[model samples]
Structures are given as C-alpha cells and as structure tokens.
Target: MSIPGEGHEDVRADEQKDGRKAGGYGLHERANPKRHRVIRLWTVVHPSVLGSTTLTATASEAPLTARLYPRNWRGDGVPSFKPSGQKGWPIRGQDLVRLSADYWWVIGVGVVLTLARFSEAFLVLKGRAAGLPLALVPVVMVVMNVVYAATSAPAGALSDRIGRRPVLVAGLAALACADLALALMPGLAGLFVGVSLWGLYMWLTQGLLSALVADTAPEDLRGTAFGIFNLATAAALLAASGIAGLFWDRYGPSSTFLVGAVFAALAAAGLTLRRRQA
Candidate 1:
C-alpha cells in the first residue's frame, strides 16, 4: 500500500478545517447552555456596516460549502445586526398648500388688522365726535387683545371642521360688521362690544391658519417656512398700516373699516380655492 504524502494529507486536513470554519452555526449550537458560557458585553456600540461584509449564502454558488467559525475557538456566535443612521422626517412645502395658504392669507389679514388699530385709534377719537378720550380707546385695544389671545386656536379648529371658506367669509363679514358696529355705536359700551367681536374673530382665524400651516409643513422645513410666512404677513401689515395711517387722517373712521372689509372680503372669497382640499 502506498502511504499518502505527509504534506498532502496535512494540506487536505487544513482545507477541511477552513471549509468547516466558513459553514454557519445552528441555533442549537448557539443556545447550548451546558457548554462554556460567553457574556460578551460590547463596550462601545459599533454601527452595523452591512452591504459588503454582510454575506448571504447562495445555495448553488457555494457548492464548495463554507462555515462560519466563531471569532474565537470557543464557538460563541456572531453578534446580531444593528441598523445604522437616523430615523425619517415629516411632510413639507407647496404640496402642503392649504397650510401655506392659511399662513399667508391669515398673516395678510392680521397684518392689516394689527396696523389698522393705530388708524382705528384716531377714528375712535373722531367717531366720539369729541377730542378722543385717551383712556377709552386704549382700554378697548387692551381688552380686544386679551380676547384675541384667548380665542384664537379653538376657532381655527372649528373653522377646519366646519370648512375654512365659510368661517373665513363669516369672519370677513363679521369684521366688516364689527367696524360698522363701532362706527355706528355711539356709547363706549357699544364700541367695546364691537371691538371684542373683531378680536374674537381674529383669535379664531389666526390660530386656524397657523394650525393649517403646522399640519401641512414637513418636519424639517417648518421653522424656515413658518418664519418666511410670518415675515411676509408682517411686511404686508407694515405697508397697510403705513398707508392706512394716512388714510385714517385723510378719510377718518369710515375709511379704515371700509378698506379693511374690502381686503378681508377679497381674502375670504379667495379661500374658495381651498374647497378642493376639503
């Protein structure tokens, strides 16, 4: 009998060992508790780098089957895969037009309203047909602002539920009516009531518009979008208020509300476009 060469047999045995090393381990082998136990406490969390190193067995390609050896000879299994990178983000932009529209439209409306107060101040004085009472007009403004702060968002949600068009139209109409009420109402009490109504309406529409923007804006771009939206509104208000101040002096109380109504009515009607979104 010819004896196998010493070098050839050793080479074959080494090949066998390599092959066995590549072949994967079964769960039973991993779960075997009776054998030596390994408590691998990972000190630093290494992100899972997959794609290249992550190997999957192709049934046909590896006819020369391989086995996975433990990192050490003790046969402790490989650690489970961990996902890398961060989580996903939220919705955004012109696609969220309802939100953007509300932000712009409401801002336009609000800017006009905020600046118009200065105009309303002189008008209220002149409307008194007396040299304006310093206390009365200021008090009206303060109370109106308080009401505005109190009532804004619920009204917006209400508007959202009922339909933006109707609420907007009604707010504009009420705005017009409120001004008329103030223009016509002779007593301080009556003026108070009228101004209060306008503030309440403002609260509703402003909050509603903001909510619309928040709801629509994508998670990442929200701060930028909302900032721009508000800036636009403020700019418009600045123009309106400046021009409106002159108009207040020129045409007096009647012009202020009339102009406000014209703009508001246009905006309210403008909301008809949103019907499709509903």
Candidate 2:
C-alpha cells in the first residue's frame, strides 16, 4: 500500500493504516536473503612504506540495515490526506500558472533588475578607464563590499517597517545613478562614488527579492517558487553580461553603462506601474 506522497510522515501514515509498525518494513536478518548478509572478514595485501610486504585482516559481526521508501504511493485515503505545506518534486507546468499576479509581478521585477546589472568586473574596467592605477584597482571592490555589508541589515529592517516596492524603486534609481557616475566622471573619486552607490543598490534589492518570493509563493510550493525565480534571475544575469560585453567591445565603455541605466529605469517604471495597479 502506498500514498501519493513521499516523506517520513506520509510513509508512517500509510504504514499505520496498513497495521505495520514504524521501521517494521526495513531490513532485518529474517527479511533479508543470505546473500545480503554482512561480510565478516576481509584481507588486504600491500607493501609497507619501507617496501616490506604486509597482510591485514579485519573482522566484524555487526549487521547493517537500510530503509527504503516508495518514490510514489497510491492509497484509497490519498484524497483525504492534507497537503504538507512543503514543496515536492515532479511539479507540473500548470503549478506555475496557478501563482498569483502579484507573485508574477515580483518575479518580473527581479528578472528586469538582474537584466540591468552585469558582472561587477565592469566596475573594475570602468575604474581602469578613469585612470585609477592597476595595482589600486581592487580598492573599488573593498569600498563597495564595506558599504554593502554595513547597509544591508539596516536597509532590510527599513523595508520591514515601510514596504518592498519603495525600497526596490530607490535601489533601481541608485543603480541608474551609479551607472551615470561611472560613465560620465573620471578619476578615483568617481570610481569610489559609483562603487558606493552600487553597494547601496545591492543593500536595497537583494534580500528584498528573497522576501518577496517567500511572501508570494504558495505554502506548499514556496521552495519551487524560489527555485524558479532564482533560475530566471540567473538566466537574466547571463544575458545582461553578454549584452554588456558586446556593447563595450563595439561602442565603448560608456555605451555599456548607458544601456544598464536604461534597463534600470525601465525596471523602476514597471515596478511603479505594478504598485499603482495593486
């Protein structure tokens, strides 16, 4: 007898209905064939480090048992079994269509945000182009990380008090400003300013996207929802980096940043429209 579910809880339930005790279905000497019995002795012949031959033997009588569960179960009471409020594999495509509009909007915003921001390596190239010395280029990363670490917690807290949309919009605007600063300004000062702004953008956006995913996903499918959203954003990032690189190769560095700014602006606008509609 099986249930249309997989998990220790469902397994236990099925076992109870079938009058089987917990752990009763697992391996025991009586249930297993002789061939499955544990080996008592094994020998190894090898040369020692000094090149002398050595023979080693070990013996034990301990029995090992492994429990196996059916991957899929069927039972008359399956329809009565409540959902576990946890994600499961073999999910269907229709499950995605069942998500709320708000959830889709959040995913859209995340995709657009990812599409706008290429790899941070572009920041290093921008700094180099602005006349920052090669040896000191890593300082841009150091400054950006310091600011991101410091602000992330506080910004997350602020979002909890206010809301997600406002903070996300602010983050997108900050990213656009950062792109402009990197494109138009020159020198170490511009690099630091742009990097700092990028950090602020990250602080505002990153955690919020995860939170939005949690808020919108169905109780039983939250993990699947998160997986889908993350996969989409990761794909967007690849596209963004490739497009940025192509633009940088052909049209100069400023064109790449300009395109990023346009994408960010578009994301912010889309988010704003969604919020108003909500």
Candidate 3:
C-alpha cells in the first residue's frame, strides 16, 4: 500500500526522532542500540589495532623531533646528539675514560670538597651540645634550609657574572667558617652562625659544581659524567661522615669539626692554585 520510497522515508524520520541524521554518524548514531553493539564487537576483535597504530606513529616521529629541536629534547640547551657530526652510539668505556682523564681536576676537587661535608645530623647534634632545647633542635635545620633557599638564586647569578671557581672557593671558605664556629665558638649563638654558614656554603657551591660538570662534559656523555661525578662525591661524603663519627665518639664533636675545617681549607687552597695556574 506504500509508495516505493515511503518506507525509507519513514525509517529516516524514525532515525531523526532518535537524534540521528541520515548523512552522518556521530554520538547520536553511536548511541543507537544496534550501532553501539556492532562497535563494541569490532573493538573487542581489534583491541590493540588503534593503540599499536598510535604508538607506531609517535615512535616514528620521535627521532625526527629530537633532531629538529635538540635543545628542547635535552631540556638544558645542550644538543641531543654527538658534537663531532658523527651519528652513532658512543662507546661508553673509552668515552668515560677520556672524560675522567680530561676532567680529573674537577673530580679531584669534588672529592676534596665533599670530604669536608659531613652529615647534617652532626650539625643537629652540635646544636644539642650547645644547649639548644630538645624541642627546638629542629630549628637548627629550619634556619639552615631557609638561608639555603634565600641565597641559592643570588649565588648562582653571581657565579654567572663572575665565575664558578670564585663562587666555589667562597663556598669552601664558608664551610671552613662554619666548621670553626661549630667547633671553637661557644653557646647557641655559635650554633646558629655555623648553621647559617653551612646553608650559604651549600647554595654557593652545589649548583655551580653541577654546572661546571655540564660545561666540561661532551653533550653525548653528560649523563655518564654526572653519574661518575655523583659517585665520586657520594663515596667521599660517606667516608667523611664515617670519619667524623669516629672523631665524635673518640676525640669528641669539636675535633670532628676541626678536622672538617682543615679539609675545607686545604681544598680551598688547591682550588686557588688551580685558578692561578689557569
């Protein structure tokens, strides 16, 4: 009884009522029970297809992106690849040995400097010995951290204007003063002074040392350089702390800091000599 296209028109009207259009598919079309069921079945059958395609496309573009914007990839304005225009994986052993040989002075300086840096726990213990109330002992660390945060930016800026060597020498001098104050100076006054100097020393030297490493190392082997630098310093720090603890138990806390002061002075002198030579 219907015209030839009347049934099709009726189906289209029903689809429109269901919020779907004849020419295009969208959220409304997907909301249809039949279409939703078919889509779910297709997804189940090809679960990884979409994911694999997306991953492949990203992986393909990553190298090109790294090449185009090497600094962006490195995040430190250093290029992402070898500097000699050679393209290949670097030989780790040979490169590391060469790096160590070329930068042995930096490594040696780091070791000497770290040997003067005993654990902060010793500082807290020193505060206690200086008659800081048990409850207020934590104030020592708070004061140190505050000074460290305040001075870090200024110290880094100053180093940028002058040089890393001068800043690092100043830091070593600060550490020597801190050690002397903690060891020889009396009372809570000395404790606070020592803690503040300790913070200043940290702010002046830490970033500059890392920057020095970055400046000296090749772009391709920076990770290795940093790794080795950290390892050397960490080992020295461990040994220094252990020696300090030994001195604390036997010769007493004052002797511990005196020994630290001696090391700091020696390191500072070494740095000065190197600076003059350069």
Best-matching candidate per TM-score = 3
Q: Give me the runs in candidate 1 sitting further than 4 Å from their true place.
A: 1-132, 145-160, 163-165, 184-190, 276-278
Candidate 1 structure quality by residue, lDDT tens digits, 13-111? 787787777553445456664442432222222323333234443432322212342332232333343444545643334545634554565456455
Report the error of model 1 at residue 195, Å. Answer: 0.7
Q: Which ten residues in a row have the lowest lDDT in candidate 1?
A: 38-47
Model 3: number of backbone collisions:
0
Q: Write the residue-wise lDDT of candidate 3 on 22-141 in tens digits.
A: 444565665697977888889796868888887888764546656766665775444556656756764456886668443667888888888899899999999899999999999999
Q: TM-score winner between 2 and 3, please give it.
A: 3
lDDT per residue for candidate 2 within 1-278, as digits (tens), equals 44465596877767687765435544453586453344221113222522442222212211121112122223321233345676766567888887888888888988888888999999988878888889988988988899999987788688988898899899999999998887777777777888999998998887788888888888768877888898899999999999999999999988898899999999999989988887
Candidate 2 lDDT score relative to the true structure: 0.80
TM-scores for candidates 1 onward, in order:
0.50, 0.67, 0.68
Residues forming the 10-long window of minimal summed lDDT in candidate 2? 58-67
User: In candidate 2, which residue ranges exceed 4 Å CA deviation?
Assistant: 1-89
Cα error of candidate 3 at position 41, Å: 27
Cα lDDT for residue 195, candidate 3: 94
Score each candidate by Cα lDDT: 0.58, 0.80, 0.85
